[model samples]
Target: MKKKIRIKKALQYFGVPAVIDSIKAQYFGGSELFSIKLDYLEHPLSLRLLGSDVPTFKKIFIEQEYDFHTNIPPKVIVDAGANVGFTSVYLANKFPECKIISIEPEAENFEVLKLNTKPYKNIVAIQAALWNENKKINLVDPGKGSWGFTAEDSDDNDADLIDAVTVDYLLEHYKLGHIDILKIDIEGSEKEVFDDTSKWLSNVNSIVIELHERMKQGCNRSFYTGTPGFNVEWQKGENVFIARDEEVMSPR
Candidate 1:
């Protein structure tokens, strides 16, 4: 059954004790933080079920959603919408030499992200939403918990505004010559970021994005339109792995 398969995976990743603790946290615990130490990681990962972070943790650690392989080691990586720094921590361990820029917009999620990625010297956490332009935007939570915050352009006087920056701004601010791997999971806002890719698409060699067509219409259309020379290499879970046709594939 599916439940048995999930238990097997949990045992494979976290062992028997951690699995029991995870179940206790999910069912009995409320809003209390817990830490689990992974054998491959230098530090323990913090999580809470109240914010819906445990599901995200399971997707990344147990399901191995970002386990796609590459031919070369990446020099630079951009983890947009890095909720609680799970993916960033995974990548930082996978590619210790690569410089990682982890961006998260939600205040609470950003705090956890900073905590999770603080031990990794290669990761630089930034609090901002990645958009097509540099400006202020509103964070909208569609009742999908902490990992589901989406950014939208708003001119309302009392809108929950946050700093939004384009991919071009990231490159300039960090002085990154090119992005070897660009991982995007910005809820439904991929529609806005992919709407115009002229400024930073060419500088990126590969992309792994989760298109949110169900949340926002035209997300797939905009993403496909923006990526012209890139070819779909594979799809793992909800993410689509894309790489430039001419460039050598990077990021293991």
Candidate 2:
């Protein structure tokens, strides 16, 4: 009789995942969008910032591929929180025909994002924040505690009111009736942004979101997921993707 393979023994003998990851990082010099071999999984695995610090673009590319396999080519992609153009670059490379609007409000991150995406022609870098309406919002980066721009830290001094616009307003102002993919990573502001999503939910085909479980405060939006017409696949980590089976939702 063949002996059962003990999980811990097997992991130790074959080298644990963390050890393997360390070796890969040292050998590969951080990861871009590449088919990386990991453990027993034959499928390619994506490691965040494999070779660079905060590889935002690479992370987005890998995250989107988790469950999003659309045959219909994307026409436009809206990146609500383009940190350093990591995802923007990946999306542009994947869908060369698609136009990307990368929104970043953090001054420090925006500088990097702009430089990183400068080589791409399809990406439009907008240093702003999306809200329920068009207005100025206090931009705050609570250091390592948060991952988005917000008004929470506004002291009414040294605060910049970024241009805030709803998805509907953007579609109408830009004369775009449809958005192929809407990727939002606004830290915890997704609740407010989603509150107005109903206006354009029917126009969007696919949505990728990173829900901040801790950001539930001050948010009044509630999502009805896994319904008959709505299809949702929730990734363990804060990321989630939602799509419509019948028709895509378009704002404006």
Candidate 3:
């Protein structure tokens, strides 16, 4: 049943020929990267894995995880923890005029992200981890594959150091007056980012996040506490959509 559903979705997103090619790449093909061509996109999306990226790709392209309805076209979109630039690419295609900043910590994932987003001029890929402060941190991979990397403060010399930046820093560095859409999937780092939202929370108009309460406690508490005036717009799959007051969704 699950297999049938997945195939159905794949056909809907990638069409018949791409789906068959994907299956062939999964079993028969070896080592070579698989490419997916969508009618809506100008270039084919390159997938590094036959298995690891399928679920993420399905969630973004097929399931439309980040599909939020807004009357206002966002001017600035920030994709924190943008794994291989899937959501960034999706949004870039959806809103070609909007400026998108795609942030990723993992080295390999950042490389693939650059490749995937190369066709879109509106997307600016930044290789860094989103954190509460602008500092160096260690990325901990808890065996949850590529999308599950988390950031933690560490002084150990052997630790994998990754550059971490705050939302405020990004705003200042890029000269963005405000963020219209802030999409966060930074593993368990939401607790830290939302713990004290007084600095940057007010500047954001909307948020779409996947809470990682199972990975780190107090995530829900911090998020809700930080976004007091925001209204819960909707939830699809694991993502929660919130907007800054009900008027944000109202047609201008």
Regions of candidate 2 where Cα sits further than 4 Å from its true position = 1-52, 55-58, 61-67, 152-159, 218-221, 225-229, 246-252
User: What digit string (tens of lDDT, one per residue) describes model 3 on residues 1-252?
Assistant: 111224665565556776676666566764435687877776789764443466798888877777766776889999999989999988898888999999999998888899999989999999999998898899987767778888998776655598999999999899998999899999989999998888888789988899999999999998888887786567789988888765554211
The local distance difference test score of each candidate is 0.84, 0.60, 0.82
In model 1, which residue pairs have backbone atoms overlapping below 3 Å?
none
lDDT, model 2, position 63: 44
Candidate 3, superposed: residue stretches over 4 Å from native: 1-31, 157-159, 246-252
Root mean square deviation (Cα) for candidate 1? 4.4
Candidate 3: clashing pairs of residues: none
Worst 10 residues of 2 by lDDT: 1-10
Clashes (N, CA, C under 3 Å) per candidate: 0, 15, 0
Name the top lDDT candidate: 1
Query: What TM-score fits each model?
Result: 0.86, 0.67, 0.86
Candidate 1, poorest ten consecutive residues by summed lDDT: 1-10
